[model samples]
Target: MLAFIKRLLIGRPLKSAELGEQKINKTKALAILSSDALSSVAYGPEQILIVLITVGMAAFWYSIPIAIGVLFLLTALILSYRQIIYAYPHGGGAYVVSKTNLGVNPGLVAGGSLLVDYILTVAVSVSAGTDAITSAFPTLHDFNVEIAIMFVVFLTLLNLRGVTESASILAYPVYLFVLALFILIAVGIYNILTGEVPQTLHTPIGTPVAGISLFILLRAFASGSSALTGVEAISNAIPNFKQPAPVNAARTLMMMGGLLAILFSGIVTLAYFYGIVPKAEVTVVSQIAEETFGRNFMYFFIQGTTALILILAANTGYSAFPLLAVNLAKDKFIPRMFLVRGDRLGYSNGIIILGLASILLIVAFHAETEHLIPLYAVGVFVPFTLSQTGMMLKWLREKPDGWVPKFVINTTGALISFIVTMMFFLTKFSQVWSILIFLPIIVLIFHRIKKHYDAVGDQLRLTTCERSPDIKGNVMILPVAGITHVVENSLKYAKSLNPDQIIAVYVAFEREDERKFEEKWEKWQPDIRLVTLHSHYRSILGPLTKFVDTVAHKAKEGDYQVTVVIPQFIPKKGWHNILHNQSSLLIRAYLLYKRDIVITTVPYHLKK
Candidate 1:
């Protein structure tokens, strides 16, 4: 029944041979890989004004300049990642590049940064999308967090169904969003050129609440840098593309960068022209849409598409995080469980974990985009700087054809990215300090995991001089709860092992219980010896394990071994097993790692 439900939710188990069918082409890849960056424009422009407006409504004019700076950084990263696609087509993105050129520690840092950013991508995107919904229908304002988490859960399940299926599901809405934004941008530009577009929603205040300074400008720039967060995802997911993976991925990256540039710049420019303030209930984009098209079909259409693209933007994180995790797992830096694919061939564990983490952030921050934005770009920028720096080093060492141009581009990108990363850390240090603190801790954990895996590999390594130990004989010890069919079957199975001796051990809490048990054993007349342990304290496992240890100690001297055969009842109904005591399971858990003792379970199915 459970299997049927799993099949229904996740689809039928996909064969390994069906993996190639999951690779997506340019159109689908664009939607799946670039959704995060594309949808970020909905809030990225607003994040600038959100920070700038704190000084005064007049400082809102700085949004366009801040956005342009963000655009420059975006251009550098897009070009740098294009080179990364061709260079590391196998696709670990920043992690692979940093590790190969920079070293192991740097690679882990890049990997950790991208992983955290992916979580934020989902959280921030869905939260902003929820903001859009509330903007359209203010009645949903109070339940924003709930709505955001629901989208994350839905995306998680969709992603777990496999890549191609998700791409097909998410592609059309992304195109619709792009079309809507372009139309809005074009109409706004035309209206502005023709002279005078009225702002009816809210008027811009000229009061200066606080003085503007360089630090404040930098903070605003850092906040607006959220626009550049998902640019590296294309490079991170080169392998997810169809044939000619790198070329397809590079083309997609260029296309994504171009669209993002126009949409982001256009939106910010319109917001400035229309005097759209970042309101708690209405978003900057929503305000711009209303001012441009005014609460008509086009206005609600923009809102609906914005909400969808923003929610689907999490698909970018779902695509990259698992792939990065698989690389880390292969490198022995994380748990091997991440290396296992689900029934649908998706990275199920990584997808589920990303969803849960996103949901946690949404709930923690109450699905507020501004609060989550400060913690957003720092993660991506760190990897951005590292990836570019790593590429520069690669060009220097290899000095391949046209290395100079490549080196200059990467060097410039690295410098700009490093400056922005520092700006993010310094300007928003109060909000971002936790990430800085946790980053090194995460790297330290990666190193510790690597050391443990290395030690395990060494211990398990095969050697020429090693030989299997010879067993002369063995003893079977059965811990019986009562005179039942399970015990009878367990005894029969134990006899088949041809042991040196068979001992049935029972622990009794009271004298009366022990007497009754002994009489029942005597009446059965079994050939096996019965050992009764009396305990006034009513501790079964402690006494049984101690007795087993003594028996094992004696067996070692005789050049034999002890095996505990436990009888586990199989109830007709699955839940009925919970009604019975689990002494057999407890006994096995107690002696699981003892050197001279072996434990096994014999199941006895109940006919009724």
Candidate 2:
């Protein structure tokens, strides 16, 4: 039934041979991979104004310069990642680059940062998407967190259907969002050209919450830097593209960057000219939409597309996080379970884990975009700086063709990214210090996981000089609850072993019960010996395990191995299992891993 439900939700299991068919072309790839980057235009400019408006309405003009600074950084990142696409065509992104060029520790740091970044991508995108919906229908504002989590669940199931299916599902909505933004931008520009100014739908905040200063501008710039967050996803996911994967991924990266630049700049420009100030319930983009198209169908269409693109932005995280986890698992830096793909050829474990983590964050922050924004860009910049620095080091060491220009480009990107990371730490430290503390801890955990896997590998490996131990005889003990067919079946199996000795052990809580069991065993009069243990504490496992330990000690002197057979009854109905004591399961659980003691279960199936 569970399998049927899973198949119904994610479609039928895909064949391994169909993996190549799942590789998406550039169009679908753009929609799936670039959604996160493109959707940032919906909130990225607003994040700057959100920070800047703290100093009063006069500071709103600062968004234009802050937006420009963010654009310059975006340009450097796009150019830097294009080089990464060509050089490391197999993907792995910052983790692979930092580990190869810098070292393992740096690599793990990059990996940890990216992991946090991907999770926050989902949380932030879903939250922002919910904000868009609430902006349209203010009555739904109370359920924003719940709405965000629902979207997370939907994206998780959608991605589990495999890359091709998810790309097909998500492509149209992303393209529609892009087209909507272009229309809004064109219409807004036309209004400006015709000297028709739009009014802000939100009340203007006349009071200043903060004083304008360099730090304020820096804070605004750092906030807006979120626009550049998803640019590296393209390089991380190069392998997901069709033939000429690197070339196709590079082209998509540039196209995404271009769209993001135009959309972000246009939105910020319109927000400035239209004098749109963010309201608590309404978003800056929503206000601009209402002003440009009024509270009409076009405005609601903008809101609908904005909500969709933001929610689908999580698809990028779903696409990238699992692949990154696969690389980490292959290196033994995380559990090997992540390396296993589902029947649909998707990393189901990673997808489910990402969904749950995002839900946790959405709940924690109450689905407020501003609360999550502080935690957003730091993780992104850590990998950005590391990846660009790794690329620069690669150019220096390898000295490939035109190494100097490549070195300069990456160096510029690395510096900008480092500066932005420091800016985040400086401006948002009170809120984001937790993330700074978490990075090293995650890196340490990575090392610990790798060490454990290495130790397990060492213990499991057999050497040329080692030989298997010889077992001369078997000493079998069968634990019987009462005289029944299940016990009879277990006894027959134990006798077939032809062990040195077979002991039928039973634990009774009452003296009368002990006598009754013993009498029945004597009346049966089989060739086997019966040992009845009386327990004042009425504990079954305690006495049974103690008796087994004593028997195992005695058998060791004769070079005989101890084996315990547990008799359990299998119920005809699933719900009937609740009626049984389940002591046999407890006995096996306790004795399954003991040295020199082997446990076996003999079950008699009952017909209803």
Query: What do the candidate models score in CA lDDT, each in turn?
Result: 0.90, 0.89
Please give, for residues 271-367, the per-residue lDDT of candidate 2 as tens digits.
9888888788898889989989999989999999999999999999999999999999999999999988898898899999999999998999999
List TM-scores for all candidates, in order.
0.96, 0.96
| Per-residue lDDT of model 1, residues 477-592, tens digit only | 99988998889899989988788899999999998999999999988946789999998689898889899999988888877888999999888898887898877777788789
Return the lDDT, model 2, position 280.
Answer: 83
User: Clashing residue pairs, candidate 2?
Assistant: none
Candidate 2 achieves a global lDDT of 0.89
Q: Can you give the lDDT of residue 284 in candidate 2?
A: 84
Question: How many clashing pairs per prediction, in order?
Answer: 0, 0
